[model samples]
Target: MISGLGLSTGVAEAEVESRRSGCLWAGTSHSQGAEVIAGGWAFACTADARGVPTWVPGGATSQAGTVPNPGAYTDPQGLFSPGARQPGTSYTDYCVGNQLVEGTNDVYQAVESGGLVFWKAAAPISDWNFDSNSPRPEPTWRSTSNCYRGSLL
Candidate 1:
């Protein structure tokens, strides 16, 4: 049996009954079509199944360049690793990189505070001393409060 009770937004009350599977189901919902609600509350953003926030194309004012320091030769995998300096190298600073550490890059952990994690990436560092004003690519790392819920792999 199937029926539609006619609801707003092209939605309708639905009912289904099947004897082959020996089951009955009834539900009501709306299509994922674009619509606005009262008081201006709407789904302004789109995300993956895991709830990772994603931006729509041409929706941003200006997108940042390549993400910084994805990972390094050495570092355990976890959350976001920030401010990790390369051994025997001073030219790189991963914290300022455009890399999304928590999503894809390495997750650096804090020895003292377990809740803290660092996100790092290679980025172009601007030099004020040079009149050319060319940004030199270097490691840019940043630290943020990491409340790691879980991991995919």
Candidate 2:
């Protein structure tokens, strides 16, 4: 799930849509074999286990630079602490430099809500500048409502 695909339908219907439509990066859908740059990485719209269009790792974009550390990273707030990982869950996290948060290099978690996906600080809610008009308890960190902004983390 790349997030913000607007696929609220059941799995069967989504599977069919995946075959018909190409891959969806943020929210906007794209045809098969399309390439997108997300979070400083180059992603190619590829097929998944069920042949659903997915963002596959093409390579690191120039903006990505080098991965701070190749292997897994340890968040200051203990993101990788012992027993932090729950059973039967799939997630991937990388070292986010000064992109999301200003100046301070921190670890963020990619959480899904609605048809959109956004990253929030792994440290605490206090570190963020909340949107005054957001409807949820946690503020929406996105720049806009549209899913595909390209510059989003």
Candidate 2 residue-wise lDDT, 114-148, digit = tens: 42334444443233222233222322233232223
* C-alpha local distance difference test of each model: 0.23, 0.36
Predictions: Cα RMSD each: 18.6, 16.6
Please provide, for model 1 over 23-49, each residue's C-alpha lDDT reduced to its tens digit, 9 standing for 90 to 100.
Answer: 100111112222212111122223334
- TM-scores for all candidates? 0.15, 0.32
CA lDDT for candidate 1: 0.23
lDDT at 128 for candidate 1?
11
TM-score, model 1 to reference: 0.15
Q: After superposition, how far is residue 42 of candidate 2 from its true place, in Å?
A: 0.3
